[model samples]
Target: MNPVRKRRLVITLLILGAVAVATALSIFALQRNMTYLYSPSEVDAGKAPAAHPFRLGGIVKEGSVHRVPDTLTTEFVITDRFQSIPVTYTGILPDLFRVGQSTITTGSMVNGRFVATKVLAKHDATYMPPQVAQAIAKAKEAHRIPKAAQGGGAP
Candidate 1:
């Protein structure tokens, strides 16, 4: 091969290799930081990661909020109408956080309860996060399927 052509080919290969490495690193970092959202039903069905931080989205069950005396720690239950998961958070809740409202809590499960690091409540009565809406819809569908099956009919 000619000297100039050989040098050009080597440089091209080096650049491509560097690009590949950078892309791979970027993907790895994203994967590490990625957080998945799950509904109470999905978590009850053992679909959520037990050790990694994830977002749990659902409606706050009616009359489920309880605050510990003289502490920021609060406990509540998040439900998808079909299932519910107990969540414990030790921080100031959002102003909109209330019973029967949509919320998303970021945390990990420990000893069968979700230990939340942050809690997010829906901004308005008419607005819900897309993931939370989808999860609620899915939970409703799942709940209906069982009833239809028991009635000996297709859902």
Candidate 2:
């Protein structure tokens, strides 16, 4: 084997190795930042991560919003029309936050309650965040009645 060719092959291998290491590190960093989104039903089923922060999306349950006077803390329940999860936030809420509103809150679950660090409310009646809409749709599909159960049997 020629000396020049041997050195060229070594350099090529080093470049490829560096690329692989960089790609692996990039993915690891991104995983730390990635937050999974879950619906109320999923949370009820114990599918939410115990310690890691995640996004919870659904409609704010009617008459569930509670505020403590002279404090920034608030509590509410979010429901996908199938199940509900209580959420607590100790910060100023968005002006758009209200009962019967579609919302997405980011935080971790603790003792059966979601401790939210950020709460995002839908801006308009006709518009829901895409993730929240998808979660609600999924929950509805999961709980839909079967055709046979609905008395639509085959002929």
Best by lDDT: 1
Poorest stretch of ten by lDDT in candidate 1: 146-155
Name the lDDT of candidate 1.
Answer: 0.88
Clashing residue pairs, backbone N/CA/C < 3 A, model 2: none
Per-model TM against the reference: 0.58, 0.56
Give a tens-digit lDDT track for model 1, residues 53-150: 88999999998999999999999999999999999999999998999888999999998899999999976546778888888778778778777555
Candidate 2 lowest-lDDT run of ten = 146-155
Residue-pair clash count for candidate 2: 0
Local lDDT at 36 for model 2: 50
Question: Each candidate: what lDDT?
Answer: 0.88, 0.85
